[model samples]
Target: MTAPARYPVTVQFGEVNGEPATWAIETLPEALAAVPLGDHGVFIVGAVDPDAFDESDVSVLELLAANAVAAMDAADRRRRLRTYEDALKNVDDMVCVLDGDGAVTYATGPFVSWIGADDLGDVAGRPLDALVDEADAPRVADAVAALTDAATEAGGAPEPTRTVDLTADRDSDRRSRHGELRLSRLSDHGAGVVGSLSDTTDLRRTRTELSAERDRFRRLFDRIPDPVIEVVLEPEETVIDGANPAFEAQFGVDETTLRGRTIDALDIHDDRLGDP
Candidate 1:
């Protein structure tokens, strides 16, 4: 007895003895057509009788593959753009995009609420300088004008960006808010500018309080009756940075001359009264 041939098979339409018949194909026939999706896989559409495939079939398959890849690329771009927009909307900082003429194009995030605006449209289509405090408006305009001139000189290349600390006036309450504004050219062709505003009102207030406290401490230190000296520790020795007036009188040295001198330089020993 002979062993039966074991081969992978696929069903195909055919005719046997002038009657319709189905037969198993061991391998892909010459008339079979297939299209490959790049890096994905191949699609076998159908198989025909031998010699039925032509050059047109190959062209059609190539065109289909190209179109499929292009469609996939477009979809990917849309997905990424959506993700970026979502992140911008949810961020805590205030972000705005401007047009080439300095009109506001888009604004988003917590800054809208701080400005007491019902929506982004409240500030949109307005000049960026309009929101700045009057005292700072001229400075901001000058900086932007300089940047624009530089971009022109460079044949439309983007100019270096700038950050300015300024105060903004809110429309709703007319309240002044301290913020740091960062400006950057958006395109190589001088298309527009993007601005990011960071609120620093609370931080500036805290810093002011700390500075006043430091000044108060310095005044009290100067008025104290006890002699006091401030020294800086170094690898070789301790150097006196400053000394109070009482310290100067006790040591019989001018406070200015004593500064920057090592503490060991002021050697003192009991000599006039012996053991007293």
Candidate 2:
């Protein structure tokens, strides 16, 4: 393998052997002629006719240098952007990109983890609605279409953001994930739309669990054997929705009187019912 390069080098305009019009540069002759430099050691001069020096020559050199710098800058910028994009693709969550027409341009990660085999493999350039559940697909499609329309109509400013759920196939398994889909205008070109998607299955699962827990509590309150009572205002009466067999035997009161009866008239002084 070739050895590493040495220290850095600097170049700038300077006198070429005391001849102001005799243009030359200072640099190693073997290094690169494409780069403006004087000579191989210290500084050197290149012979150019004095009459050739003109405003046009200066402008040409300036343009050449500017073009070179711009090319180099563009190359570096592209390299960095590619590196960042690769990193994003490797992320754990499913990521999908969509165009202005709601067609998927790219898909990565385990989309099937939440959505089972929905034929997501040949997904490139396919509309997102196909992979989504029928119930939720139209809602999400309308939202995305609206975003694209607004983006086109919205002179320069970016369109407002929106989030929606979507489905996809992953590894022969059909899964349903809470996908957060975002719609944004891609730069100033206005040629297409760029979409970003993230999986939120865990959040949805947690919400479902909370709903189940609330239902469980309601069931317990309504079906328990204890003589649970509820008080009502306005008429000031008590309602008995739940009671055990022992409640009637111990209180010596019929079920009818126990329900919708004014508590003050019952005169329940027994420590068995409450602490009297």
Candidate 3:
């Protein structure tokens, strides 16, 4: 096995006495020259003319160094972008990317499916508004504006979220479904927006059902003949929130005076009241 290198690996410019053979660096007795390519590596040219090699040759090699470094940087960027695209494929949420003009440029497989598109090709280059329902256009516009404005103010801006009603297809506009949209500026991707959409149909339905049940319970609590008091139970205390008219009259205490105070502070509950 090859032993781990103990010395820090580095290259020195110009022809100098060093262990080039062990490091695999080419050395020429005639003329060996090199230019630093930033931290990437060094551009080495050997077999240079012993007499013709001068400062002008170093200047030309410097020019080549700039172009070579730029090529390496571009190649590195392409590699990272490929990795990002690969990672996005494994994400479950619907992912959408917009261009500088607010036109849809890219969509992951999940996003394409969410839009009811046959494939990504069908969804590209369309304005975001084209894919969403007309009724939700105003909210979409506002969220987009907020995202863009936040991005402009700071590179690391917080994501803005909004709930938008959606439809299967652009032409349908039925908008029978809903999604929670969390969006942020993709300054790294472009001066564009990258957003994930999660379906919230079940959540919205649950909220609606809960509101209806609360209304019904409030009606029942108001009309019932028994004395009733609504209290928020906590680990340390039970805070009185509401008292029915029967409870207030029977206890000889106005709800306004009893409300917002814990049971212990009021000192009215008997030992039986704590059994439940």
Candidate 4:
């Protein structure tokens, strides 16, 4: 076989000749009929006979190519889905497919492990809301109901996708896991809901710790005895954002009113302000 050539269409053409040629040929074929199979490459058939290839032959090839493309497309989709499932298996997040009634039709391996289930069958057919913490169950239900209502209002059109943060009730020692639940309608007709629950427990804890740290710093800063003022450094000059209680008492002006007012606007004697 020869390398595929791109002309009117991509194809690989070759011929087998012998002392007693079984297949009689008047001329060497230039191109062969072919069909693309996505990333799997092209499927090439017998070489085209320019003289014998008529409109009827063209129709046959077209039909065959159409079927081949469809099959290839389906196979490609399954391959991609397998790859996605494999990736999700190792991830901390859980992927799930829900039916119209919000029942779990399919779930990733992580979900099964998190729930302490032997397999997907343990969770399958269960209401998705049951897996959520009792505190978050109502919120999850409301979100799903709203999507369903919106789809109905739109005359069966797909509802807009939305994401919500909720806690999942796990059977493991973890007990509960904070997750961001991304919910979306699977089809244009709103046939079902597809969602992914990404574990955000660590992220939420980090944010909470950072917030507490910030509050501690603010308390310490405000309690300091020295006259302290926060200023915004500008290209032309500096503007006061706020001043502590000591500075406020010395200046005889409230920090709120002093804010946004430039230091130059203040009455200073003996160039004391220049010392800073």
Instruction: Give the winner by TM-score.
Output: 3
Give per-candidate clash totals: 0, 17, 0, 0
User: Candidate 1, which ten residues in sequence have the lowest lDDT sum?
Assistant: 1-10
lDDT of each: 0.69, 0.56, 0.69, 0.69
Q: What is the C-alpha lDDT profile of model 4 across 1-276, one tens digit per residue?
A: 553344343332444573332444434565566656545567665555556556787678778777877676556545554565566567666787666667777788876665457788888898777866678777777566555544576576445676878876665665466778888765443346668777788899999899999799778778898778888999999999878897776656788888999988877465453355
**Residue 89 displacement (Å), model 4:** 7.5
Which parts of model 1 are misplaced by more than 4 Å? 1-87, 149-158, 169-176, 232-239, 260-262, 265-276
Candidate 1 per-residue C-alpha lDDT over 1-276 given as tens digits, one digit per residue, 9 for 90 to 100: 232355445444778889768656565544667788765567565554686667898788878887886676556544553554576777767877665556666778576665446788787887666756778777666556545545566576445687878876666866567888888765333345667888899899889899999789778767777768888999989998888776666556787888999998875555522353
- lDDT for 43 (candidate 1): 58
Question: What is the lDDT for 209 in model 4?
Answer: 100
In angstroms, what RMSD does candidate 1 have relative to the true structure?
A: 11.7
> Which parts of model 3 have CA positions greater than 4 angstroms off?
1-83, 148-175, 188-190, 267-276
Query: Poorest 10 consecutive residues of model 2 by lDDT?
Result: 37-46
lDDT of 4: 0.69
Off by over 4 Å in 2: 1-87, 112-121, 149-158, 167-178, 188-194, 223-275
For model 4, what is the alpha-carbon lDDT of residue 113? 62
What global local distance difference test value does model 1 have?
0.69
